[model samples]
Target: MEIDQAGKTNGQQPLFPTPSSTPPPPPPPPQISLSLKRLLTIVNCLLLCLGNAGGPIIVRIYFLHGGHRQWLSAWLETAGWPLLLFPLSLSFLYRRRSNPSAPAVLITPRLILASAFIGLLTGVDDYLYAYGLDFLPVSTSAVLIATQLAFTALFAYFIVRQRFTPYSINAVALLTVGAAILAMHASSDRPAGVSVGGYWKGFVLTLGAAALYGLVLPLVELTYSKAGQPVTYTLVMEMQLVIGFFATAFSTVGMIINKDFQALTREAANFGLGETKYYLVLSFAAILWQCFFLGAVGVISCVNTLLAGILIAVFIPMVEVLAVVFLHENFSIEKGMALVLCLWGLASYSYGEYREAKEKKEQIASPQVQTSAV
Candidate 1:
């Protein structure tokens, strides 16, 4: 047979064809529609509520088991739960280290300053919340605090990149109306031992905390998403933890210096506990746990997570009701009204989410037909 001109004279074919280096197809952009986003928001808010409610329950348990201030002081001194997160945070840091293609978010001094502001504001909000619980029923706190969702929506619209749709606006209005009714109920149900001034102070503190917290969330979210780094999330949370740790620590120290610590220890020790130090430790543990959970919420969605904390609104009121019933505290018609309004508002929020989700699904499906026809 004649040798083919295109073939190798030795009858050996090339090991590889001429390589055609075509660039890979670009990835599709993430599809985030308003409806889908709203659903995520509602879900996030619900989880936050549930997580937040746990904090009060833990505090109650620590005192019930004869905890004391020294223990709380020491627990805080140990670097708290934020220290515990070092491992996970390090893992995230390392994983991203080799990611050369990661999105560029300028971690400038300005951003760090903003992060600090958000952290400080967050600390203030939680400080007020913790302090208010001392004077007011958790129900009252939860009810008044529900206004945070409305406040957050406003902050997100003005500060964050999120555009407020008509539905979001209506959700805020409905939630506000429902929360106002709940607040009215709380006012009516105030116990005899709660001073008018104390009640008002608690009210103002909770509201301020909620409003400031509302502002903090979106900013942190903007920073973290843009930065795409664990450091930003860790940094903001660490600042809040540091601020909270100091504030609480100083307050505990003041109590010790003023001799209230000894009095509390003596009282708790009389219950046959060897010392009141255990109580303090347990209390610190509880707060530490709360800090960890709350920080996790921030990692997910700043504003949405806080709004989802309204889930606590549901349980907190019920928990308070149960505590009052057990302790022979008076319950009134307003509490009933408040609970009803809360339930109604929760249902409305859920319905709105469902409706939005359905719309998104329909839109996603409708696009397929047009694509096929084309």
Candidate 2:
């Protein structure tokens, strides 16, 4: 009843068809392209955008509460906050040093010099950003800052020999559209906004800073990729921080030189150290954030690390809303819209990255399986 054994019946080859199709070659695995990867890189840049926006938002809150020019000066003015980062970073460095695989020799002067350069770059980047805030809205500044993604891609293409894809171009278009929307909203209105303390000169300077910061990543990679182990990377960063702190302090020397030392001290006491203490707390928070950032980058790819900034942006508006409801502050709808755009952009960016990653994982696993089967 099953079929004639080893004999043709009605010209049939076999009852199971003799695996004629060869399982259709497993349907040929899914294909990915260079363009898709470029999209992911853009998504990472979106994360950086959110981070850029968050800074101004923080500064704005301070400004609303009668804190003037604090973001730049607060860290140095407080002893506790600056020291916090040093210890945390040092702890990380020590852990790396203690690893059995780490070399026995101490870090060299050449490494320190390289690290200092990075620090200087970082310090200048901050100053430039602060300068831009003097002329632009928090929302607009965030959009403008998104340009760094473009810069990052440009650097990657030219320096790292990374290729760009069509997806990257599309991602750039989305970011640009969103940024333009945000920028239009920012420039359209001004109510109780801080007056520009300077002129076009300030704007130009800030733009320069953004460009320089955009350059820092490549520079760091170029210098340290040769000798930097993961632990040594931390040491490099620490060196940069040390140098940046001093450099910034030197620039602000005018604050010390021009102001009456005795009168300023008296005024500081009258205002009470409570406000200064607030700066100290924020500075510590900044340091903690930096640690978190570095850890995130270390554990995940740089793309993921950058995209995580959207989480920060998402939180900013929520915090602002809570302040308005509980603390009784007036709210601006414009700020709300800007936040919404940033969140949406972030979501799109993240989805694109996830899809790309999932595709890559499948692609890698499939080859191995095929080879084993063969």
Q: Judging by TM-score against the true structure, name the best candidate.
A: 1
Alpha carbon lDDT of each predicted model? 0.55, 0.49
Best by lDDT: 1
Clashing pairs in 2: 35-165, 119-240
Clash count, candidate 2: 2
List runs of model 2 lying over 4 Å from the truth.
1-54, 63-108, 134-137, 166-168, 189-202, 228-341
Residues 101-197, model 2: lDDT tens digits: 4433344677667755665566556656655655554444555665565565566556655444444445555554545555555544332454544
TM-score of candidate 1 relative to the true fold = 0.62
Alpha-carbon deviation at 29 in model 1, angstroms: 14
- RMSD of each predicted structure: 8.7, 15.6
Expressed as tens digits, the lDDT of each residue in 195-217 for candidate 1 is 99987886888788778767665
Poorly placed runs, candidate 1 (over 4 Å): 1-47, 57-80, 83-115, 164-170, 185-194, 228-281, 284-316, 325-328, 364-368
